[model samples]
Target: MIDRVRRFNRTVTQRIGALNDAFLSSDRSLGQARLLWEIGPQGCDVRLLRSRLDLNSGYLSRLLRSLKDDGLVVVEQSGTDGRVRTAHLTDHGLTERAMLDRRSDDAAASILAPLSVRQRTQLITAMIEVERLLVASTVLVTACNPRHPDARSCLRAYFSELSHRFDGGFDPTRSISADEEELTPPAGLLLVASLHSEPVGCGAVKFHDDARAEIKRMWVAPTVRGLGLGRRLLADLEVHAAANRIRTLRLETNRALDEAIGLYRAVGYHEVLAFNDEPYADYWFEKTLDRSTAPAPNLPDREH
Candidate 1:
């Protein structure tokens, strides 16, 4: 597997002109070319560019300087906040970016030109898988205050999705809630998953003083589904629960979310008798995490 992956890496990098200092038959290296593309016509905040590209501060500064020296880009400090800097493309940079786009399209066409229709379909499918897995690998999950802007963004999306999917048109106020107070600090936590600085998923947990933890507000963006992010979020919540000395973990879900139910069952959650009166819940599940001595759930799974 390692050899296959390494050979694939070699083939793709060589085919993509990654080894060339003059990529796309241009004067700039691929790094410089990518910088221009990322800067785009609207420009970008320098710090954000660094995060999105995963570049070291010195390396990014050096690239910006090199582009500036070539008169291909401009970097300027914000008027209100001198500490903040933004990168904008010059006329030449825009032209260069356009040329790069054309060349990239040509390169893609060239790769497909040799393949039969079936091979092309297979190649495209494989490429999609590779891209999805790569993006999934880059996602970062962190515990944060539920009130943070990005956290709120994920919750808003979650609620909007629920409203559309629920038969009666869901209302947050009608359901059992994980309010801001419940998800803050010593009581509970909200975990937000980010991909290239954009929030992609979020999950929360409320503790009952080392006795149990209830998972809440769990969601992953539609664009990023089927990448196992939901499982990652669940495993992280389990870690948090264990750390908090929570012996059991529980969650309730609406019948509209079948995928979520499948995930819970796959990850060891078992249906139990109604433990809470959450209005929207059609199923309630729980898992006991006992380290030293505990039998797995072999008992028949009960459902409401």
Candidate 2:
């Protein structure tokens, strides 16, 4: 099994230019090249980049220093909040990034050059699957504001999906209002998962300053439903609540959401009496997130 996995990795790496020393040989390491690409034209929050890359603070700081020393990027304090820093590529860095993009295209073309038409089509299909899986692997779950654009986007998508799934359809205007300030730090949190630039799933925890917390708006994109995104979102929300000293998590779901009910039960949530009079809720659940065991695995992406 290990050998097979290794072989698969080797094939993918070779095809994706991962083995190419010249891929970004101009001056930067692969990590730095990736950082440059992630920085983008609008720049990015340094803290966000760290979270997105899952890099240690010290290591990320070193990479930033290296880029700054090379005159390839600039880091500046946010004008609105001096404590927050943003990273932007310099003009030279932009030029280098463009070159990297071209190199990426060239590498892709190189991979296709040796393939017959049928083989090329098969390869592209496989590549898409691999890309989707890789994206599924990299998603991180953490506290967020429900009002954050990405979080809102995920909620909207979730509602849209429900509208299609429900016999009577759904309407966000009729759904419970999720206040932005309530979802901000201390009061509550929203967690969103994304693949590349697209929001794929979301969940929220609302803390009442009392011992109990409420879980709300749990959802995963239909395209990624089987990837375990729902479970990941649930587990992450529990963790966030626990960290806030919340002891119990309560949730309500519609009868139409049988899968969600099953997920909650399988993950240790118990049937509970109605906690709130949500017009849409037909089932209620409560769970105490036990930190004694390892948290549930992050959701895998739906396989094509």
Candidate 3:
């Protein structure tokens, strides 16, 4: 099994020209090439890079040092916070990156060069599936700021979905305000799942001064719904709450949100009296987060 997996990885790496030695051709490893691509034209936060790439601090630091030594990148402290750092590519670095881009294109073209038209189409289709699966695998659940672009995007999608699903047609303008700061750090939290460059799902937990938290605005995009994103989002939110010392979690949902209710039930949330005067809520749920047996529901994909 290990050999099969290793062989599969080798096949993919070879096909993608990952073994090439000109740096883009061979000298630098795939890691360095990917780092340069991620750096792009605008600089990126070092912390954000680490999270996005799912890299360990030591390994990421080593990669950054190598890029700096090669005169391809520079890292500087943030103007607003000395503790934060940003990375930007130098002129030479940009040129080198452009070459790498060209090489990648060439590599992809080489893969298609010998294939018949039908074979090319099949290959592209299979590649898309592989890409999506790989993307789904890489997505990590981490605490996030509610106001962060990805989180806001998820909320907007959530509201838009509610408007379509609800009898009255939901309106965020009329919806109760969700405090952004509450989702920032120690006090409360937001969890986001991103696949590639897009945010696919999110969940928020707002902690009271007591030990309880209100789970709010939980949502998964229609496109990615069936892949168990909702359960993952819920689990991540609970984990975030647990880390912050929150014991009880409560949530309210509209009657139209039957799937959510089912999810809550499957996850061991019990029916409870209304905790808030949510104009749209028809049911309320409360659960004491138990890491051992949280509900793991399989979310269905939304039909297009």
| All candidates: TM-score | 0.75, 0.57, 0.56
Per-candidate count of clashing residue pairs (backbone under 3 Å): 0, 1, 11
Candidate 2 structure, TM-score to reference: 0.57
Model 1 whole-model lDDT (C-alpha atoms) = 0.85
In angstroms, how far off is 282's CA in candidate 1?
A: 1.9
Q: Which of candidates 1 and 3 is the stronger one according to TM-score?
A: 1
**Among all candidates shown, the one with the greatest TM-score:** 1
Model 3: residue 177 alpha-carbon error in angstroms = 3.1
Ranking by TM-score: 1, 2, 3
Candidate 3 residue-wise lDDT, 71-168, digit = tens? 99999998889998999999988998888877777766777989999999999999988777766677666556676787788878988889999998
Selected candidate, larger lDDT, 1 vs 2:
1
| Candidate 1 residue spans exceeding 4 A from truth | 1-7, 18-24, 28-32, 41-95, 113-118, 290-304
List the global CA lDDT of all models: 0.85, 0.79, 0.79
Higher TM-score: candidate 2 or 3? 2
Candidate 1: how large is its RMSD? 6.6
Superposed by TM-score, candidate 3 places the C-alpha of residue 210 at a distance from the truth, in angstroms, of 1.7
Clashing pairs in 1: none
lDDT of 2 at 132: 78
